[model samples]
Target: MLILVTNDDGVRSPGLRALALSLGEIGRVVVVAPDRNRSAIGHALTLDHPLRAEEIKPDVFAVDGTPTDCVNLGIHGLLSQRPDLVVSGINCGLNVGDDISYSGTVCAALEATLMGLPAFAISLDTSLFSHADLSVSTRFAKKLAVDIMEKGLPEETFLNINVPFGPCSGVELTTQGKRNYGESVVVKEDPRGRKYYWIGGTENGFEDLPGSDCNAVHRGYISVTPLRTNMTNDKTYAVMQQRSFACMGDID
Candidate 1:
């Protein structure tokens, strides 16, 4: 099997390299990732400017764009053979809860799923992004990869797995968790006494809900949440279908 590995954390990230090497044990590995950290870029693509992908090493390419770009280039243009699966991350930080909407790590997997490939995103929840942290996380990644190669995921879905900072007891099938976005932005002064805004800070708290990814991770279990490329709310869609909304068409 050919595995195309990419990440939002950049080409030189220890986590990215670790994941590539771990996946390498399973299949042929090709690493195409951002030349610099493109964290929290979401599913953005470079449209106005030409994207560049440089071969930094054997089977390793550094893209001058987002994680989404790396995956698109890796499968569509870079590789001679089609990749059987796409995997992103072993990211430096946790991409659980509401973080997924802003995570380029998750977006890379989304991009591959959009391109009709089986994909998964892995993240390790920790402050210590050391090689040892990666060692623990990549083990979970390898296990998931083996199961994916054997069982296969459903169409339009990709796994978003988040492993705890230390040893996890086990793994769980979970739903995306929710967390209140509090103190996400900070305002500060520059050297010139000018105001500058920082976009994000620590999240406050996770909802007290069961079977959520956050809960599983909090309980020292790896959280495997299957996310879909489409954001449609199937239950809401059915309910809306029964009601005729004037907004559905031109206003009379």
Candidate 2:
């Protein structure tokens, strides 16, 4: 099977390298990732500007675009054959709850799913400089990837896997968790009297909602949450159909 690997932390990130090495033991691994870190870019694509893909090594390419662009290019243009699955990350930090909404890691997997392939986005909840042993995390990610290739993911669904900051006990299938960011952004001034902002210095608080990704990871387990490309709330659709706004078709 052909497996395409990528990450939001750039092509040279240790986590992405570790994941690629681990999955290489299973099948053909192709790595196409961003030339630089593109974290929190969500599911955006580079439609306005021309995307560039450069071959950095054998089966490894770097793209001057977002994570989504990497997967789209890999499957459509770069890879020698169509990949059976596309896997993103072993990212440097966790992507859960609201973070997934803004994560380029998840967006890479979303791109693969849109292209009709089973996909996964995996993350480790720690900084690279920390003494976090990535062996277990990468191994688990490989195992999950293998399982996905064997069992196959549902239509339009991609797995978002998040590992906690310690040794793992086991893995859990979970729902997207809730993250409450307490004073999330920091306001700073760039050069030339211009005010800028940075999203740093604070952590998002979470709770153990049963069967949630946050709870599983908090308990030192790997959290595997299946995500969909569509953001529609199915439960509220019927209610929305019943309500009517009367401001259409008449210009008075």
TM-score per model over all chains? 0.94, 0.93
Off by over 4 Å in 2: 189-194, 246-252
Compute the lDDT of residue 107 as modeled in candidate 2: 86
User: Model 2 reaches what TM-score against the true structure?
Assistant: 0.93
Worst 10 residues of 1 by lDDT: 127-136
lDDT tens digits, residues 1-252, model 2?
Answer: 889999999999889899999999999999999999998899889999888898899988999999998988898889878999898988888998888989999989998998899999999888772577888888888888878888998898999999888778888999998998888789987788899888855867886589999989999899889899888998899788887756655657
Cα lDDT, model 1, residue 150: 95
What lDDT does model 2 reach? 0.89
C-alpha RMSD of each candidate structure in angstroms: 1.7, 1.8
Candidate 2 weakest lDDT stretch, 10 residues? 243-252
